[model samples]
Target: MKFLHIADLHIGKRVNEFNMIEDQKYILEQLISVIESEKPKGIIIAGDVYDKSQPSGEAVELFDDFLTKLVSLAEFVFIISGNHDSPERLSFGSRILKKSGLYIAGVFDGKMNKITLKDEYGPLHVYLLPFVKPAVVRAYYDEEIESYNDAVNVIISNEKISMDERNILVAHQFVTSGGVSPERSDSENISLGGLDNVDASLFRNFDYVALGHIHRPQKIGRDEIRYAGSPLKYSFSEARHHKSVTVLEIKEKGNVKIDLIPLLPLRDLREIKGPINELIKIGKEDYKGSTDYIHATITDEDEIYDALGKLRQVYPNIMILDFDNKRSRSNISFEELSSEKIESKSPLDLFEEFYEAQNNKKLSEEEIKIIERLLEKAGGIEI
Candidate 1:
């Protein structure tokens, strides 16, 4: 069986405060082209389908177009809801949608909704697992589970089939050693010690594990488990990633052949740092490829009051700016600030001995009051 794997499309993403509606439309068209050219039997989108829980109409249409395209050539398509998705909204017409070769799981009903597809080599059974937090799982079971680990274990253990089936598991959540992007999680997801991290050992029973939530395509511990990454560069941190979708070909004998199909983005993301003069060398073009989104940092000796204005004349789509100062800034070093000795007699404790030798033991009323105020404001420095 041959299938395509993609995730974190983030269809409603607002890139650099500009509407990416056209860009998203182009990508959805590209995905259709891939499906028609490759003729994959099925496709799997792990999670984070939309940028917002309540997505805009444009985002909904973009998603509809992509799904409508895939169902034309693909025999089966599997999708799960992520933390960013409103499950009820995404899973609209779940019963009817599944009949059109799409299987979606937004609610954890404690049952595996397995979709079976046929190829020359028997059948492939794919199990869809959506994003579920510890609290949600506990509520589903009506029991108190200690952590997400317990909830995950319970969900996996309850599967009523053997591990040896032609099975695939799809999930969306953080796992150890995964890469993240800034475009996702608008300040809420970055809490509680980044505890969303899960271990790779959870999928030991499955034939292959398709994962998501990490925006950079990578293999977790082994090739059998992997993330296809996002379709486009979603944030500043994802500037260095070469976005891709994966194609997996599996045979009846449990032989797997996975191919990385790289997606060339409509506009590249670039970060450039240098002085204004060097940055705008009129004679040459350095960032010719990244004409869409560029973040520039000016390390100038003097402030160019309208640096952004000047840069806009050169690169019209410039999105970010920063001024870096590497000189004329003095502060105590870390060693100096943190090092204080109290094991021996402190200077204040042995004031009389130190005063006799150096003749500088005490401060005047003005100096003493200033020191007292500084200490009080500094939270009364430790010791």
Candidate 2:
């Protein structure tokens, strides 16, 4: 049986304050085209159906239309919820939708959701394990589930998985291989110091493990364990990512083949660095991707008047404006300063110094008065 693996739709997302509704709509259309051509038996959307816990009305409507079209194209459509999604919201009408070959495993109900499908070889068991934390899993099981790895291990171990049949696991978590992490982008919300990582060794029994949460497409530990990254670039850090959908064909138990079908977006996210005048000149003269979402870094030492206005005339969709000049670079670092010097200064003096260090300029008299009033309200050190 052939199936397409996709995840992290992040519907109704906004990148750098620019709404991506049109971009998402265009990409979904392309995805539908791909589905028509591939004619897969099943479509697996691992997790992260929406960007936020409470998505906008337009986002809900867009997903409704997409899901409707998906059920018409494929025999089975499997979906799960990620950390960003509200499980209760996503699980709404799931039982009703299951009648139409749409299986949504949104809430973790103390057991893994398994759906059996028959093919030429035998039974293919597809398990849907939604995003779960240590606390969430611990509530159901008495086993000591301290970390993410322990939680996942306990959950899978409890399942009566038959090694004889071809089984596929769909999950969303921060997975690592032998203490090494997968390539990550700024868009993903990973815990500090690798606190949320679940080792890939736990998934050795499954034929394939389709993963999500990380926005970079990559394999973890083995070829069968993979992450189907987001369809569109959500940040400038992902400017180089070649977004694609994973297509898998399961011939029999322990026999699986994979392919990556590239996905093209409406407006590609990009980064451009140079003087404001040079960037504008290039945009006007030879730059073909003027409408592309851009993060522009101005390198001019002298401040340019109306730099954003000037750049917008050429590259209309510029999302961020940054500076790499001497002023920005010359900002003082507190770490380099002496601790004695810091301790000797008054609280108000320290605030003024810190503010100047950050903005490359001193605070005004009115700003000082505002800080003084705030300090007085708190009954802090005398100014």
Report the lDDT tens digits of candidate 1 across residue range 1-383.
88899988888888779777777777767777887878888889998899899999989987987788788889888999988888888788988988788889877777557887667777677888888888777766755577666677778877765656678889887665334322333222434665566677777787788987878888887788888888887677777878778988889746888898778777777787888877777314755653667788888867577999988777777889886764323232333333453345433333333333333235556755665566567786422
TM-score of 1: 0.80
Query: CA lDDT of each candidate?
Result: 0.74, 0.93
Tens digits of lDDT, candidate 2, 229-338: 99999999999999999999999788899999999998999999998888988898856688899999999977688999999999989999999976678646677668
Candidate 1's error at 68, in angstroms? 0.9
Clashes of each: 0, 0
Off by over 4 Å in 1: 142-144, 177-191, 282-290, 327-383
Q: What is the lDDT of candidate 2?
A: 0.93
Candidate 2 stretches with Cα past 4 Å from truth are 286-288, 331-336, 339-383
> Which predicted model would earn the best lDDT?
2
Query: Model 1 clash pairs?
Result: none
Residue 219's lDDT within candidate 1 is 83
